[model samples]
Target: MTTREWAGDAETRQVTEVASERELRELIGEPNDRAANKIRSRLHDLDRQWLARSPFCYLATADAEGRCDVSPKGDPAGFTLVLDDATLAIPDRPGNKRLDGFRNILANPQVGLNYVLPGRSDTLRINGRGRILRDAPFFDDMVVKGNRPRLALLVEIDEVFYHCSKAFLRSQLWQPESWQPDAVPSRARIAKGIEAPDIPLEQLEAHYGAGYADRLYG
Candidate 1:
């Protein structure tokens, strides 16, 4: 589709775009002074506590060319190790070997992480530089089911803060009654369109399910 068609129309595009920070700030108004001041350049004790209780987080990274990706990382609570006030170590669990986000981190050290807990509305956000570590000591600490990760992402903190609960409140994300059931296509089904079409759907599902069910750890 053409740019104009994809963006709705010229008027819609013009209305949505704010060309400069000045213009954007004018539209949204200044952020809260207290909120702005709350952002820490390092992880504090409270931040460490939050990470300790978080079983899931989203790791966001962008390549040198600015191509971005967000990948979900989850484990038991406290799976992410706070190596100190300034560093965090996240084990790179076994997966399909795409490594899109990890490759982006190699090209561009900058990364963002958002930590979430099951019933909590507020999420902790961490912005930092990342490096891949394959050292035995790093992997030794993150072993799961006798399987140690072959690699870990070490993050040096730059900014850390708690995002407000407005988003979760608006979506009612934690409320079961607010959720709607839907039939979601499996990854195998989606891949068949662009990949191995000759593979039977049942075979693909069986393989995929078994991998997730039995081989989650590396």
Candidate 2:
């Protein structure tokens, strides 16, 4: 079916867009003092402390043409290296390695990060300029499970702040009762359905089953 048919008649639909900063500000109002003044150009002691406990983060990058990607990075707590108040480094690990975000960093240095700690509603956010390093003097310090990262993304901070937890609260993210893993297909089934239609479902299931965890760091 055509898009107009799928979305119903466009002329009869209420489609409103906030087109400019003036309209957006008029709708949401200006930020109060605390929210407006909270942006920082360097990481504070509190930010460092938060990084020490955060095991996961989402790396946001966009290429010169403005295509974007958000890649998830995780390790044991404190995986990120805080080189100084303005500089930070994230070690790379093995994966399918499409290198979408890394390629974006090559084309555009601007990057953003959202750090998360398990069971925590609030998040730490950073906006910075990023560069990829094949090797660094501190790489030895980033060793994990007998594996030393061969690459790391270094970021020079431009802004840092703690994000509020309202989204998490509204979604009940931390409440176990809100989880419904079975609401969607399993990983194997999903791979077969969307990515590998020709592959046998049983093979995909086995690939994602008992031995899957063993290949995480391999």
lDDT of 1 by residue, 1-218 (tens): 11332356444452334468888787788888998699898888888889989999999999999999999999889999998899999998878799999899889999999999998999999999999988757678788888788889999999999998999999999999887644556777866666779898887787777576676773
TM-score of 2: 0.93
Residue pairs clashing in model 2 are none
lDDT of 1 at 42: 85
Return the lDDT, model 1, position 189.
80
In order, what is each prediction's RMSD in angstroms? 3.5, 3.5
Q: Where's the lowest-lDDT run of ten residues in candidate 1?
A: 1-10
Error of 2 at 50 (Å): 0.7
Candidate 1 runs further than 4 Å off? 1-16, 186-188, 191-196
Worst 10 residues of 2 by lDDT: 1-10
